[model samples]
Target: MIIAIDGPSGAGKSTISKMLADSLSMHCLDTGAMYRAVAYLRLHGDIPEHDEKSLVQLVRKTELNFHHTTSGTQIFWDGIDVTVELRAPIISQEASRISAWSAIRKVLVELQRKICGSGDFVVEGRDIGSVVFPHTAYKFYLDANVQIRASRRQQQLKEQGIIKDVKTIVAEIKKRDFHDSTRKDSPLTKAAGAILIDSTSLTKAEVVQKMIIEIEKIKEKLGKKGKTN
Candidate 1:
């Protein structure tokens, strides 16, 4: 079973998806971190962003792996654990920018599909529902107001010991939303049949519980059809 959760930044897709996966005993993959790892590689390796050929080659040659532990998911880039570094604010912007390139998305999208294909996964990202798992039975698009999203992002960064002005975060999210939605290769969008979840005023637990209920309903309907057949 594959559950795709698509959303803009700070909508709590990562946290909610993790909880949902735990509730169902399925693995959860964060596709954004994959791209962020790419950005991390380029930045650390001194590869130019506009150098598309180099970027694609870098991604193809480097090995990206995800290890989900009791605490959280650990991302390994080329056998080195770079999970903590990938969350830096600068990498987020770079990941967003590089993600616009068609070649880059093709490589990472293929990788994402291959990873999720291996197990029952709750996949979360900008395009998981719209592009990565378009045919999945369960899909959800999580969204919240920009201000609320910014506030949430601020709190998250604070937890990471990275402080930024709320207004700055708000502007960054707006810019990110535009980039993600307007990207050419696989723009961020709600997939057909995906349930729309507005989490502006909702807590993370509330969102995950609502999603679990919907998933169970879908599972029950599928079971009935299978038995009938």
Candidate 2:
């Protein structure tokens, strides 16, 4: 059973997906972090992001592995721990920039599916449901108003001691939305049959509870069909 949690930044996809995965006893795959790791690599390594061949070669050589730590899943790139570094503002922008490239998405999406193929997974990303795991019946799209999302994001960064101007963050979020929604290869969209949740006023626990209820309903329906068949 593969569950997809698709949403933009600050929509609580990452937090909720991990919680949902734990509740369902499934692995959590953070596809957004995967992209962030790539961006972090290139930014520090001085790799040419504009060159498709160089990008592809770098991706092919970069060994990205996930480790289940006490704090949750941590990403390691080429034997170095990069989970904390991925949240840097520069890397976040770079992730959004490289994610639009066809070469980068192709490499990461393939590897993402491979990681989750053997286990029940709660995979979260912009295109997890619409592109990465389109065949899965368990799909969710989480969204909130732009201002609320910006506020949430700013607070999160503040808690991390990274001070970013709220207005600048909001502008960046809007720009990222435009790019992700307009990208040619796999644009972000609500997948057919996806359960949409407007999380404007919901807490993370509330959202996870709602998601659990939805998943149970789907599971019950699938069970009845299996018995009838």
TM-score of each: 0.94, 0.93
Candidate 1 accuracy as TM-score:
0.94
lDDT of 1 at 33: 86
Error of 2 at 79 (Å): 1.2
lDDT of 1 by residue, 1-229 (tens): 8899999999988888888888888898888888888899889877975998898897788777888653457899878899988889899989999999898888888888887778788889988878888888898999999999999899989999988999999999999999899988889898898999999989888999999888878879888542110
Clashing pairs in 1: none
Give the per-residue lDDT of model 2 (tens digit) for 1-229. Answer: 7899898888888888888888877788888888888888787777876776786787788787877532357989888888988888888988888888888898988888888877678889999888888888899999999888899899889988988888998998899899888988788899988999989998888999999899888878888552110
Best by lDDT: 1
Compare the candidates by TM-score and give the number of the best one. Answer: 1
